[model samples]
Target: MGISENINEILLDIKKLSPYPEKVNLVAVTKYVDVETVKEVLKSGAHILGENKVQVLTKKHDELWDYSVNHKWHFIGNLQKNKVKYIAQFIDMVHSINKLSLAQEIDKRAQEHNRVIDVLIEINLFQEDSKEGYDYQDFLNDIPALLTLKNIKIKGLMTMAPYTDNEDLLRNGFKKLRDLKDELNTLYFNDSLTELSMGMSNDYKIALEEGATLIRVGSKIFE
Candidate 1:
């Protein structure tokens, strides 16, 4: 199937999972894909695209600036401090902010650009050895300090489930993220922490079922 067909099919499947499909944001992951394919995804009505690396995102942002005016670009990978400046100007949101220092750097760059950057707090739900995110208790303990930052807005939480075929583990991971969001909302008494940026191509349906408002899918659409 073509890019357009794949997107259409994914959108259809998303609708089946929720009564209000429009609420679920589909961020088409464009990492490792060509600009042509990215354009095809945009042409197919997908307005949000995510990239895992700043260099690639920068190249594409420059090359496709005209085509990207109406689209939202997201940084969905482990971001290095030095690379934050490169993406601060154009990235719509950063989905993997795992530490206060990184968030501070992002805010510094965003202030220089005179833009308020939106970010999601990445939670290490399963305590994976390889993942980058804040542990549950640490995140809670740091909320007050995080709220003090001026140039960045905390939109919500993000998480990655372990790569496995076990349905129970996947669902539990997603559910924990949803529960965490709920806990934070009640603690803060605000709904501004609204986005649950969980899920990927392999397990988006489960993510949606567990209350993921934003999902990132790549190979499923681009390959």
Candidate 2:
């Protein structure tokens, strides 16, 4: 199938797997694809584009500026403080705010742009040293401070499950993140933390089954 067909199939599967399909956002990870390929994704009806690197995202954002009227650009990777200035002007939603200092930098840049950027606190549930996110326990202890930032809106939580084909590991990882989101919402945000940004091309169905509000799919459709 082509990109459009792949997207259609994924969207259909999302509706079948997700408890709240209407609220679930399908973010097509476009980090590996080029500008024209991204255009093809937009044409496929996948309007939310997710990119990992700042330089690539900024370049695509400028090249695809016309599509901005109908699309949203999401930063879905480890963001640096210095690089925040590059995409701070129009980043639709940041799905990888992993630390307090990073959140502060985003807040400062968002203030300069006079915009409130929506962000998700990334949690390294598996505590992998290679992963870029707040450790599970650290995030719990830091939420109070993270919530105090003025220019960035804390949307919810994001986590990447360890790369594995084991269904139990995938489900448990996604469920844990969902549960964490619920716990934080009840304890602090009062049900405001609605999004669970989990899953990717390999395990999105499991993520959706476990209540992921945002699923990032790339190779499945783009490759």
Candidate 3:
């Protein structure tokens, strides 16, 4: 199957999962797909492409520009502060914003790059020691510091739900992220926090039902 087939399948699956008619975004995670494959995907009406690493995105981005294809570029991995300037030059959005210091660094670098950075507040809602996010209690604390960043806008929340077959946990984790996203928007102190980037190949259906505006899927589209 190719990009069109994969996109059609994901869309049909999303439509079957919810009745709200939410325009879910399918970011053709390009961490694995090659340039020719990406060109084929672009021909299939797929625009948004996600890259998980700064170096990989820079390399692929340079390669893609040679094809003269204009598409949204999203950085969906851990971003180091030192690389923010270079990363900001290519990416349209960053989805792994986990700390205020990083946010501040991104804001500063984006200013130098003359681009306003759109970032998602990543939440380790499951509290996995191995993962990163603002904890439940520290949520309020994170919000204020985030608001202080002038060049960066908080678009929404992104999270990595615990790897589990338990449907309830999966659903609740997504719901929690939605609830947080809504609350951040309600603060009104900052602008609207609308985009929720959650879910992946295995649990995207549940994530969409809970209002995931952006889904970073890999294997499903890669195949």
Which pairs, if any, clash in model 2?
none
Which segments of candidate 3 are over 4 A away from where they belong? 188-191
Give the clash total for candidate 1: 0
- The per-candidate count of clashes, in order, stands at 0, 0, 0
Between candidates 2 and 3, name the one with more favorable lDDT.
Answer: 2
| Alpha carbon RMSD to native, model 1 | 1.2
lDDT (10s digit) by residue, model 1, range 1-223: 8889999988887788854677888999999788888888899989998999888999988889987447888999999998998989878999998988999999999999999999999999989999989998888888898889899999999998887888899999988898889889889727778899988889988888888889899989966
Residue-wise C-alpha lDDT for candidate 3, range 157-209, written one tens digit per residue: 89988778998999998998888777766664454787889889888899988
The lDDT of model 3 is 0.81
Give the clashing pairs for model 1.
Answer: none
Best by lDDT: 2
Tens-digit lDDT string for candidate 2 (44-127): 899999999999999999999976448999999989899999999999999998888999999999999999999998998877
- In terms of TM-score, which candidate is stronger, 1 or 3? 1
Sort order, lDDT high to low: 2, 1, 3
User: Which is better, 2 or 3, measured by TM-score?
Assistant: 2
TM-score of each: 0.96, 0.97, 0.92
> CA lDDT of 124 in candidate 1?
94
